[model samples]
Target: MLTLSIFAVLLLMLLIDIPIAVAIGLTAVVFFVAQGQSSFLAMLPQRMYSGTTGFTLLAIPFFILAGNLMNCGGTTQRLFRFARALVGHVPGGVGQVSVVSSMIFSGMSGSAVADAAGLGQIQHRAMVDAGYKPTISAAIVAGASTIGPVIPPSIPFVLYGAITSVSVSRLFLAGAIPGAVMGLAMMLAIWLMAKPRNLPKDPRANLHEIWDSFTAAFLPLMAPVIIIGGITTGFFTPTEASVIASLYALALGFLYRDLTWKEIPAILFTSLKQTCGLMFIIATANFFGWFTIFERIPDALITQLAAFGTTATGFIWIVIAIVLVLGCFIDGNAIFLITLPIFMKLCPLYGVDMVNFGVVMTLLIMIGNLTPPVGMCLFAVESFAKVGIWSLAYECFPYLIAILAVTILCAFVPEIALWLPNYVMGAAG
Candidate 1:
């Protein structure tokens, strides 16, 4: 009943349009005061500070900056050109390009909103020009953007590793195959719709064109290879990889001359704003997470689940259902921060592997960005889409199903997420 009331208040605050960070902080404050535990408020400052102090957490900002720089530095466009060269001639040509391009960009940005807002403009424009419907074009962009975080170099995976003390390198490796699976599934959906919907088909590029496009994107393309290789080879940590990624992106901005020195300030400012918002949420949500642990919420949940003989698979399904429903109403980061403590405890009891769960959880969280009511990717695409949110949401259904299928696959077949990590890291402890 206590947990119910706290969440009820949190949900009410979210419904009323309160900022996620503030809403969480306020809910904790209100409950503490009401319970005559206002003394806990004294630790607020310390807890919030300590929450943002994790070394792994340092990667978040650099990754965000790297993504911002890449977006502004001609990286996204080159990736799109290369993707189009490879698949632009297929049925649902432009749509296929959007998915493939997002997969490539995902390897760098590790952010759905970045992909949606940055690559999305190019994709939506290209699709519209190629004769796709405006609504479908927007949906394709929004849906494809979800692929960003599922690939390597993911911000969510970094945060999950920090919060859970899981291996960030393993998490990065774990995402590789599932991300590819998502791209392929989305492409298949587009292909199935091609004939009936009369999706456009562009002329295939010759070998020379493909070679030239790849060469154009070669440097930017190296971002992921450098990141994954450096980590797997024990050369650098994920946080260091983020710094290298940012530096590389900055170099590309100048080398290609796509981003001028004057643009650097604006790019840094944009990355700063995003990083600050995310950090604030982390700060407050950390306090809220502590409150849940203090109240023994995980203990209570474990008791209830045990009473029902819940299995690992059953636990995953429950989490998926909750995440998908709450995803419509809450930001993915908030949901992650608030529920992580409770979920982490259940992992061992249910025999679920943390590394595998990390990938699956990250995939589910990104799916939230494609959902309506507060879907960040939907709004990002809608900014240029000019289509009603509902219409865009409607069109995203097929791609959503495709992603959810991959998520379910990961949850059930742990090997899907764990195989690569185990192969490279010699199995996670």
Candidate 2:
């Protein structure tokens, strides 16, 4: 009866188009009120407060601010120049630039939506002018943008880590390999598709031009290295690393004379607005999570699943299948926050390492950003590039298959995800 009621309320809220965070919070409140549980009501505020007050969560705002700062401070243009020199000679040169720029920007920004919005403007115009199809250009930007969370300083990773109590530092390390693999996969797909079409390539830059772009992008490129290096070396926590990243971005912008005093207010305002929206979602998720716990939903799920098998590998594949289906509907972050506690409870039964699980989960969530209905990156790129959503969706099939193949590889072989972190950062303490 309780489960049915909860679902009903959830569906009702969804039909009305309430924000996900609000729907979750309201559903939880309705559940508690109906049960007439006084204790649960008392616990709600504390749970909500604790959920939003984590020291680890401080990284969210810092990273958001840093990304905004980098975008505004000329990092995007420098990286674009570097990408063009490196890959602009290929068929669909500017198309390739979109993919490479997304890869580079992933290290700094971590949000696919931001990547699409920021890089889409530059890449779309160039690709259109070069005689590429608008749908192809839009599809490329949307597909490439999914790479953001796979790279270090990933916002999704931080949120997942906080919810599941995994080490954000180790998750950052784990993402390095998979992120690179995804980028390569996308590049290969583009090369194959674009070659037969005889798409135009940008003239190869000479040595002086290549060297100039490289030198200009050098500092911005090092932003991820500094943050990841500091965390892995025990010099600072993830929160502290975020602060360092912001400071570093600020320094680069000031030194490069890219960020003027006039731009400071706009930057701050943008960061603050984005941060508030994200943090509100986190806070509301906290309230919803409290209700989930009080209802014993996770424990019920564990007991039921235990009836099948207890092995880590089996449980992982099961969860992956579930997330993929869910990905077709829900936004990635909402899925993460709502389902994390359930997964965390199940992890111990399978003896799965939370750090490795974190990486795998991040990959799966990113896949969602590329798929249909509610894919954030897909919609953003399609709208901006003025391509029909259906056409872009059809074109994305091959890329989807390639990404699924890589995801399956990561799932079966945990070493691909964990090796770099262990080798480069040593074991997490």
Candidate 3:
């Protein structure tokens, strides 16, 4: 009865369009108070505090700052030049550039929204000028941006690690293969879709031009290497790597004269706002997660699913179905925060490696970023490209299928997600 009531109230809140964090916090409060467990209220503050106060949580702000610094310091443009030089001569030239840029940018900026906004401007304009339809341009940017969280330094991975007690480094390593596969999938989809149209391609850059662009982008390109290398080598924790990333960005901005003093305040303010929003959601999720455990929801789920033959593959399919469906309506981050605790309890029973599971979960939720109604990246790309949302959704079908294919592959062949992590960690050991 309590579970029903809690879920009913959550559904009501969702229907009324309440903020997810507020809805979660309020629902937990109402459920606990109704149970007459007044003492449970005391757990709320602790949960919220512990959630935000983690050493891993420190990485969130630094990463946001680093992304901001990179954008403001002109790194994004330089990366764009390098990407265009490589792929702009291909069929659907700008579309290919968007896919490649998103892959590279993913290693630096973990946010899909950031990737869409940053790259959408350049890619969308180029596509339109080259005579591609606005909807197709928007679709490509939206689909490509989803690659952000599948790559290393992914914010979703950090959140998953913090919530699930999994190793973030291992999760980062696990993402490498899947991320590469997804990028290739997007490229293939674009090739097929654009080939019939004979989309205009820029002439390939000469060797000297390619070298010039590479040299110009080298510093920004190395940002990911420095962060990932430091973490893998035990030179620093992920949190420390974030700090170093921020410092590196700051140096590039100020010392290199890329970002001006006048821009510093705006950049910091924007990053802080994003940080606060993310932190609030994390804190509130902690409160709701506590209530969930107190209710034994995960245990209830396991017991109930046991009646239906709880084989490992069956359980994974069930989870994938649920996440993919729910992902259609909710933001990926919200799904991550809300469902992670539930999965953490259930995964061990299925012999699932937590790190590999985290990678799959992150990739699945990221798919939501391209779908309808509430896909943040979809809205971002549409707004940037001035494309109609419905038309963009129509154009996104092929790339969506590509993403679904990659999701299923990663789901069924866990080694695809686990190989790099296992190899790297084995060498280290």
Best by lDDT: 1
Model 3 earns a TM-score of: 0.96
lDDT (Cα, tens digit) per residue for candidate 2, span 1-429: 555567568757866788877887788887787788755777766777788888888998888888778777788889988999989998768878888988898888778887887766777877888888887877878888888888888889989989988888889989989888988888888888777877788998899998999998998888888888888888999889888988988888899888988998898898889888887778778888767877998888787677765667778888899788767666788778877877888887787777878878878887788787767888878777777777888777767776787788888888999898788767654
Per-model root-mean-square deviation over C-alphas: 0.9, 2.2, 1.7
Residue lDDT tens for model 3, 6-106: 76797678778998888878889988888888787988889988889988878889888887787777777788889999998987788898899889888
Worst 10 residues of 1 by lDDT: 420-429
Give each model a TM-score: 0.99, 0.93, 0.96
The whole-model lDDT of each prediction reads: 0.92, 0.82, 0.84
TM-score of 2: 0.93
In model 3, the worst 10-residue window by lDDT is 420-429
Model 3 misplaced stretches (Cα beyond 4 Å): 1-5, 427-429
**Per-residue alpha-carbon lDDT of candidate 1 for residues 1-429, written as tens digits (9 for 90 to 100):** 888899899999999999999999899889999999999999899889999999999999999998899888788899999999999998899999999999999888889999999999999999999999999999999999999988999999999998999999999999999999999999999999999999997998999999999999998888899989999999999999999989999999899999999998999999999999999999999999998998899999999999999987789999999889889988888888988989999999988999999988888887889888999999999998999999999999999899999999999999998999898889733
Candidate 2 vs. truth: CA RMSD?
2.2
